[model samples]
Target: MIGRYAKLNVYQEIFKSSDFYRVAGGAFLIPVALLIGLMSNTAVIASLSLKELVLIVSVLVNGFPIIMEAVKGVMAKEVNVDELVSIAIIACMLTGNYLEAAVVSAIMVAGALIEEAVSDSARQAIESLVEMTPDTATLLRNGREETVKVETIRKGDMLVVRSGEIIAVDGVIREGATSVDEASITGESIPVNRLEGDDVYAGTTCVDGFIKVEAVRVGEDSTFGKIVQMIQAAEESKTESARIVDEYAKWFTPVILASALLALLFTGDVTRAITVLIVGCPCSFLLAGPVTTVAAISRAATEGVLVKGGGYLENMAKASSLYFDKTGTLTRGEPGVVEILPEGGRSAEDLISMAAAVETGSAHPLATAILRKAGEMSSSIPEAREIVSETGRGVSGMVGEKRVEVVSSDAYGQKGLTTVEVRVDGDVWGCLCMEDEARPMATKAIRDLGAKGINDIRILSGDREPAVKRLADEVGISRWHAGCKPDEKLDLIDTCVGSGLIFVGDGVNDAPALKAADTGIAMGLRGSDVALETADIVLMNDGLEKLPFLVDLSRKMSRTIKINIALSFIINLIAVVLGFAGVLTPILGAITHNIGSILVVALAASLRYSKG
Candidate 1:
């Protein structure tokens, strides 16, 4: 029953292709002509029979494009397999085998369309982003809601999204609460309850409740738009294996044509030569690399891993060493205040409130951690004024009458501790120790990477040596370098330059190393904009578990391409040998070629089932 359903789906693919209808309308006349010839023996032209006239029309509609491509290929000094099939169609016509000529042309055309449908299956996930995008959005303005085109929305525009509607832009909720089905964005099925101030992305459906969202990114700048663009770019990219196939194809087509010429000259059998031409298109071999690459990329996307291109997947499969950024990558990225110490008879709440007040409106991980602890430990956080922050150092502001400062500290060089001094006026009010724990799957992910052939696993960080070391040991990584500045990380990665080196990082500090590596993967959920833009691949779900999955995917893609090519070669070789032996007719040869291409395409499409 499963096999029957699968066969039905294949037939559906053939019928649904728009090319099918165009070719069918012309080719459908062949059977009608055959019926008329049997009934009346009618001649459309004085010198041509009805079957010949029908064949010409079918060739014009179904075979004309391929024949013109063959002509263009010759003019461009590019030899392609289309030339072989084109010559075969013309040969059948000259021999007055009109029925076989029309049949072969239609079959070849149908095969190409089927290949196209199968190849495009890779973009199905990305294409759904476009289809799910709502064209119009309800704009809330001056206490009234106006329905307008989503394209007209700009940054800062408030959008009122209700239950069952797809959010049209990436924005922050300003009012109310709702459960959003973020499956389109993150591939997580369970609808998540979103409160006021929570970030929402475009294409995520509002499951229930209502919210007024302030648009932050819209149109092409939206996350959905950027993802679509990335997937399209990935599909258009050609891998190294694909390039090799193209180079061989340039030489391979001529060899097949030479064999056909030899058969015609030696045996004086035009039918045998035509059969060889019909079977020698090499459609399966030509499509093997790209189909496998696209399928692998699409499969990876489903697991929330966005690969930038096929070349990256090819590069990743060969990676031997992996470099990691300690914070916000292998770690959960959410820093929490571990312990707070106060001086001058002050309570811990007072210090946390002062630090949180000054850190308010800051996006730094440390600042966020401070604010989060304040919300839990302190009753109320006083409003801060005149806040100023020094890059990579600390933040200072006027909290009430006293000047509060949260400056970087090296108090305890202990494992995973990040301390910041809380100063009241010029005197130290004490310090707050913070820690970012390793992700729940970090150890497992690292272990899996080793199995996948990532030999050298190293950690790079600006944190204290003890902190970096602890996290490294926890994740089973023995090689680690701490206190490395941005330029230092860049220099380290440069020294490790090789074909398969990968650097995983999450912030601006790691951007340089990411760009320097063979494949750079960014933690998309919490990654800085610089990191996201610089990295070649993004773990959209922000899970380290996907790392092993990604590595496995890349290797599998490499293997799948090889397997597909081998299958194509074996099938085509069998068909060509039969053609040379005069055992296959032109029609049978065309059918065999179509079957071979379809089999290869099916194998490539099966790559979508890759396990994460």
Candidate 2:
């Protein structure tokens, strides 16, 4: 009679608690308790046949291992996801709630399988990245290039490609010229014209002409290598919801134990105590947050957006202020000749020739722009030696023993110029002016943030103060920090933490700042080595406008989490009340309580597929 009552109470607890494992574990115990009670009752009333004995033995044989495992796991103090399910079985066995125990275990196993399937859905993202690079390309070998696996293309190898071929590595154009479509790497839609001496990135297609490139970076050192690293780093970051759930479970288990003990003391009923223990397993509640995050991450990967970890996702939702790195993040990192002014009794062509000759060896976008303008004039470049470049300060080279300098106006110690001076051996030759145009989407992203009540926007850059200020003015960002070093950028981010900053950057130097910000948005299309890995959100399409869309999505996800948590707490509260009042049977209570847990899980998982 005592055991039967105990079994009933156990079922009641399983029904009351939102923890799936504890409830399921208790449910599995029900059949064993039922069999024991039935056989004991039968033995006293009638003689059992040998065939009947065999049938009972078979049922016990099937159930014994499962029950034994559960008991062993609990005794060993191993609290895995399955551990609570085991304890639930034990509770059901003691209370004679056989059917409820089996049902509970079945539900738990099913839910676990579903969660596993959903989490594994991330395989597609990695596969998509792998498919981006071609399997093989022609390498210049034995005085003539032949087809070979892209992976086998070693450093310093020369590769020849036709007009329609993709560039296989980060290399300089050793021979020929072509218009390369770098839309895959820099998101530049207009096919960029390349020539002898121009650099090409791996995975970029040669849209027009033909070029033989000498490999500079190969294998894992290429841009593709950094992207793969970013994908892996993003996958490893943790989510805030999972952390909170852990803390909740830590306290929840103890509280449940206390409640069960109190109920046993007051009523002097072991069955009632077991019921409380079974009900408070804390499994489903623990699963609620991770399931939602995993689902959202899976959905994002399908859309070509890679969120690094759970923590990144959570931070993006709460981000307030946005710190934009002007290059790549706000403006196309490319610079074009916006204006040309003549000074010092010289023409625009003279200034262009001088600037281009000095910048021929430079890698800056502005330098390239100047060089192209000179090339358009068919101006011959002078052979230069002893080339040197400095941040803020521009490129300087010795052309035929004549010192030539092509520095930004700010670097020359002059204020913002609609025109830059060209100097030869410390005498002004002429001026060639240029400016970086803001990306078409930059204005819209800022406006959208304002409309969404995120009013604060700032720019932090290591570029010349004048250039930084000019770009900031163009973008309408009033709060700006120019001439900042890498460490200073990180400090600026830390200062903005009270406002919940979102840092957007694409260079390797921006990595520390990105990691320090509340949410780091990497412009993946142009982002450098460390920036991609340290960032939380990656704009794969290089669209700054996606910022608003992601912000809205994060807010919606946060709201969903709140709703699920509220529902879980309410259901648990109601079940507890019903159990204390003796208004619910162990079997009905367990079933009803589990239904609520399932509902919470379903709602949380829905976030993954939600268009919101």
Instruction: Quote each prediction's TM-score.
Output: 0.85, 0.65
Model 1: how far residue 298 lies from native, Å: 1.1
Candidate with the greatest lDDT versus the true structure = 1
Clashes of each: 1, 26
Tell me the tens digit of each residue's lDDT in model 1 across 1-612. Answer: 000111211323556656679878767977876787787658668898876787788878777777888887788886757888888888888888888888888888877776667755755665565578999999999999999999999999999999999999999999999999987767677899999999999989999999999999998888877877787778778889999998887876778888889878987998989998888778788788877887888888787778889888888889889999988888886788888989999998888888899999999999989888887874488899999999989999998799999999888756568899998889998899988978889999899899878989999899888889878888899899999998898888887776678998884567778888989999887743554578899887777888888888898889888887888888878888888889999999988998888888788888888786
Q: Judge candidate 1 at residue 216 and give its lDDT.
A: 96
lDDT of 2 by residue, 99-156 (tens): 5455544444434334333333423344445556777888888897689988888888
Q: How does each model score on lDDT?
A: 0.83, 0.64
> How close to the true structure is residue 68 of candidate 2, measured as C-alpha lDDT?
57
lDDT of 1: 0.83
Between which residue pairs do clashes occur in model 1?
Answer: 416-467
The 10 consecutive residues of candidate 2 with the worst lDDT sum are 1-10
What candidate 1 gets wrong by more than 4 Å, as runs, is: 1-18, 40-44, 75-78, 338-411, 419-433
Candidate 2 lDDT: 0.64
